[model samples]
Target: MRHLIPLLFLAACASTQDPPRGPSLPDTCGAGDYSYLVGQPARALERVLIMEELRIIRPQTMVTMDYRAGRINFKISDQDIITDVTCG
Candidate 1:
């Protein structure tokens, strides 16, 4: 009986689908779509809406070399402005 309870709990926690979040992200990152954000203040990104992962890179910030598909990268210049948008 104890095993049955644990098995049931596992089943309830198993999920193979996107949560209630609106839509699934694309297979590849789309940097161009966010090009408009360039020249904007980095703080603006905090209020930006997105479904994919966002990585904010500031000047001299050490980041991982590993690239992940569908991940958006925002590079901030020393002036705190968004200098570039790339998909990693």
Candidate 2:
């Protein structure tokens, strides 16, 4: 029985999934597609500000961006896991 308890504890500790945190973006944002916004100068500036709030991209950081399904996909540092993104 003691051994079983230790084994269960080890098994529980071994799980690697991160806990759920919160929403991907803020509530105030209404924009839907960033690709076209990237072309417009004013929207680009506003997008940068929103991205900062979302922690999706940092100021002056190099990120490969893509527009997918009305969201700005930001790839930073080469991990498949998306760190941050913003709505278009």
Candidate 3:
């Protein structure tokens, strides 16, 4: 039908304007430590107890940083890549 073409185009344009999708970020009370061994716990750990009180904690994701053609690059996925040179 003729109406289908315009509907498809509108849907395609609408999707492009949305922000990146993934797991939403949790609230942080304040800055804390996120290191290992006998010294102190991570900043995230300070807000709540681990393994005993709260069980909803998830591991922090590892990001890969790189440099490509004079630009700094951070890649989260095959489709998710960011490049910046202003801070460099």
Off by over 4 Å in 1: 1-27
Local distance difference test, each candidate: 0.86, 0.46, 0.31
Compare candidates 2 and 3 on lDDT and give the better one: 2
Error of 2 at 24 (Å): 4.6
lDDT: worst 10-residue window of model 3: 79-88
Model 2 TM-score?
Answer: 0.26
The TM-score leader among the candidates is: 1
| lDDT per residue (tens digit) for residues 10-85 in model 3 | 8887755668698733324211222221122323234543332111112354433431232221112232222111
Q: Number of clashing pairs, model 3?
A: 4
Task: List runs of model 2 lying over 4 Å from the truth.
Answer: 1-13, 24-27, 35-84
Candidate 2, residues 1-88, lDDT tens digits: the string is: 9779988988998869899888665523344433344333332444355442232454457555543434444423333233333543
Candidate with maximal lDDT: 1
Q: Report the lDDT tens digits of candidate 1 across residue range 1-88.
A: 9779999999999998977877644537877788899999988887878888979999789999997987999999999999988877
Candidate structures ordered by lDDT, highest first: 1, 2, 3
Using Cα atoms with residue i matched to residue i, what is each candidate's TM-score against the true structure?
A: 0.64, 0.26, 0.25
